[model samples]
Structures are given as structure tokens and as C-alpha cells.
Target: MLETVRRQRRAAALPYPQMTLAVPVAIEGAALHSGKTVRMTLRPADADHGIVFRRIDLEGGRDVTDIRVRHDRVVETTMSTVVGNAAGARVGTIEHLMAALSGLRVDNVLIEIDGDEVPVLDGSAEVFVDRIEATGLTALDAPRRAIRILKPVVVEDGAKRAALLPGDGFSLAFEIDFDNPVIGRQAIEADLYDPCFADDILRARTFGFLKDQEALRAAGLGQGASLENAIVIDGENILNEDGLRYEDEFVRHKLLDAVGDLSLSGLPLLGRYEGVRSGHAMNNRVLCALMADETAWEVVDFVEASRPAYAAEREMLAISAD
Candidate 1:
């Protein structure tokens, strides 16, 4: 049974046809930093359109922002991923939605938003995933492309670090340590293409220390934050009445953020990503570094299991055949 499942997962992880939503989906919620209610519509796009954001409320939708999902467009990463264009138009707190798109392998989308930031619906990707799934996905005629790591790339800031190495399929390992006893240290590793993503990673709410709430608010951030949208840790206790979604929810959420950050590369990645106490900034830095050295990565249309270009392919095949 285990071997059969591994084979099925490997087959599913193979390069697939480009896909887009079958129909438009709409969502409305409060923006995390601004605390303002906003409406967003996820619309399907043709092949190679990638993911785009249009500020419909500005100039009657003339202000459209193409989300390159790259480091150059990332204007801010202090609290959440913010992408901006040269015209000064920006969309903040996009990671959760991006993660949902990546997890479902939605290749091209046009996100129409009436606000500067995405709504922090439940402070997790769950709501976004639910709506997108409800709309369903349709595969395009074009083949999908993946960014295959040819060599290792690493970035570090103090004790925080993020890296990517050649691998067959997308996988991530993340570790986070917080002084608060409620979190402490936790780590997790999983293949991004696995079914576990929707069940495990998508629902883990973003968390913060109760002590930092006031400071964050003073900094004009987390204005929409409440016990309803996020997990709040006060000392050794959890302030949320329902408690955590997972035993190591903190680290799982970190991995969720990483998935969203890495998806900014515009192409699905075929590599192993490892992060240690890393956040949005570090994740973007590693991606930038990888892209800077063109020799470190290549764009491929398909994964050839026989050639075994990546180390993880051999391991995956071995597990599948066992």
C-alpha cells in the first residue's frame, strides 16, 4: 500500500498540463494590515498569463499589477509579502493566497482586488483553497514549465537561513524556534505535491506573540488581526479558545509561508528547499541568489525519470518500487 501510494504521488508530481480555474471565484474579508474590508475575484487566464493582480477600485481598473512572484517586485517583507510595480501600485499580504494557488498548481490567474492588500481570510490559505477548489480547475493545452535547480543556492541572515538544492520534485523542510514556551522549537519536512498540503499546511493559521501585538499595531501593521484570524500565544499558553490545528503548527505555518514565497519565482520549482528560522525576506533572498547565478537553475518542461537529473528522483523511484 505504501509503495502504491508513493508511485501515485510521484506520477502526480510529474510535470502536468498548465491549468486555470474553470470559473471565476470571489472572496471578501478584512485586510490584515489595513483592517479594511476588501473584495477579490479570481478569474481564469490563458496559458502563460501567470498570476496577476488588478486594483479595480483605482481608476476603474486601469491600475493592473502583474505579480511576477519574483524578488524584484517584492517591495516589502516585514510582516507579509508585498509586491509592487514601478508605478507605485502594490498588493500586500499575498503569501497565503499565493500558497493556495501554488499548492493546487494553478498556472495562470487574474486576481481582481478592490484594495491594496489581500483579505486575511482566517489568516490561513484554507478559505482561498476552499473557494478555488469549489470553482474547479481546467488544464490548458500548453505544457507546464518548472524551474529545475542545477546547483545549490544559499542565503543567510544571522542564525536564519534558506537554501535550495537540486531535487526531483518540490519538497520543503523548515525549522523555527521561538523563545515563547508555547512554540519553542519545531520542524517539519514534506513533499509539496503530496495530499498532505491541503489537509495539514493550508489550515495552519499565522501566529504571533501577544507581546508584539501592540508594537505591530503601533507600526501600522496587523490592524485587522484578532483571535479569529490568527493564533495568539501569550507566554506558555495559547490565547485561542480552540487551540492549534497541528501539534507543531508554528513550523507548519512557516513551511506554508515558504511555499508562497518561493512561488514568486513565476514557475513551479523542482528542488529541495530548507529553511532554518527563516522568514519571507530570507526566502526571497535565496530565490534572488538562485536566479542571479543562471548556472544554478534551468527551466524545463518535463521531468524525465529515466535520466534522473535530480537526486530526489532516484530516491522517489526507489521508494515507489519498494
Candidate 2:
């Protein structure tokens, strides 16, 4: 019996195989912060390769630099997520693409770019999700792994906070309160395990306040921000002619950001995440806190899943060395 099982494992017949893109996809647009035109391509990768960003524009593509998408590689969280290597090769605003990959369960991909930031197409993950879906996905010959929260891990900054708690499957709840009357207070909750719900999250666009435009420009940010890419609020009303995508779009966008930020873990997460007015910094901080305490989390394989009382499928989380 042991020999039979060993043979099966060696044959790469795993219960849950990792996934990668079936074909290469490309896109070109203006980066949100830099306001510079850039092009990016997503290519298929081998199993266990993880998601990596390759800077092909560096030194005029003479020597390409690869940066793995992982939490420890995160170097900045100022209005956007930025990952860098020791040599200061950095890529910013990766949260949207990251979220799309996480939702699609794409385990391995090679993202080649000719820019410092991923193009903020409509300030949402919809473009990325659509392109990837059209290209399709293929299963690899390796088992999938996820970080299972064994205990509650929390981080807070004054009134803002984020937490990851033990759960059978992935889910998120977020609440945000803006001073502007147009936004005011809003909250959203979703079972990310559901593909349809995740798709909705991907469509939620990032928002900004028109009042802060000058200040943001002075600080060298939001250089490419415009009504076409983001929902701009002007205190009492939304500046966009088309108006809101969802009634609670403000909060939904926050939840969308959390999905992308938490994906820095470099694997799918099996747990519940709750955030209260949290931003990029707090999201990264919460992840750091979860990883700091060794007893809080464990790597587990997807053996199977069961239909729970909730609408989403509850994964049966476990791992075995054999």
C-alpha cells in the first residue's frame, strides 16, 4: 500500500493541482502614479514558480530583473503596494493584478513588464481578470498549498484595524467611514470562495477625493488619476458622469484592496479577514503580524471540500507529509 501511494505521488497525480495560465496575455496603458505609458505581459509558468514580476525595461532590457511576489519583499505601502529587491528594483500598484490571480486560483505566472507600475486600467481588477479568463488556465503537476489560520491574528492603528481569523474558507468583511457626505459610512461583506462574488469584487474601482487632487500632485502621486480610471468624489457628489457601480462601492473597493494586499502571502489563504477603515499599510502590517507568530498559521494542502451552510464551499483544510 505504501509503495502504491508513493508511486502515485511520484506520478504527479495529486488531488489538488496548482494552476497556471494556459497562454500568454498582454496589455498596455498608462500607469496610475507615474502617468507614463507602459506595457505588460502575463505568461504561463511551471508549477511552484509562484507569481513573479520581471522588469524587462530595466537597463533597456539588457539585464532583466525578477522580483517574487511575497510579503517579505514588500518595501512600501504608501497609497499603493510596492515590492522591491535588495538592489532597489521596485514595482508598485500590483494589488489589483494580484487580487485577480488570487481569486482565479492561478498559482504560477510570469508577469513581464516595461514599467515601474502595473497599469491601473479603470482602477479595478476587471481588465486583468477578463484577459486572464479569455486566455484560460491549465492545471500543473503539483499539489496546491494554502495558509490556514490556526488562531486569530490582529493588528491595529488607532481606530483602523485588520485581522485574520480561523475559518473553513476565505471571506472578507470591511467597513469604511469617509468624512465626505457623498461617501459617508459604508460596509461590505463577501464570501470570496464564491467565484461570482469574487468577480464582483474585481469590478469595484478605486476611488479618490477631488479635494485632495492638488495635494496629491504636490506629493508626486495620482499623476495618472482621472475620472476614466477612478471614481472621483467632490465632497457632496460623485464627479464621474456614470456615477457609482455599486451602492456601497466605496467600501467594496476597500475590500477589493484588502484582497490584493493580503495576496502578498504568495498563496491562497483559508481564513476570514475583517478590516475597519484599513489601508495598504495596515493590511501589510496585519500580514506581518500573522507571520511573526509561528503558532498562528500553517501550510496545508486542499484534500477536499464540503458544502457548508453558507453559500460558499467550505474547504476541508489539512496536510499530510506522506
Per-candidate TM vs. native? 0.89, 0.90
> Candidate 1's residue-wise lDDT over 77-116, tens digit each?
9999999887778899999999999988888999989899
Q: Candidate 2, which segments miss by more than 4 Å at Cα?
A: 1-14, 60-64, 303-322
Query: What are the C-alpha RMSDs, in order, of all predicted structures?
Result: 4.4, 6.2
Between which residue pairs do clashes occur in model 2? none
How far in Å is the alpha carbon of 55 misplaced in model 2?
0.4
Residue pairs that clash (backbone atoms under 3 angstroms), model 1: 69-264
Residue-level error in angstroms, candidate 1, position 185: 0.9
Whole-model lDDT values for every prediction: 0.85, 0.84
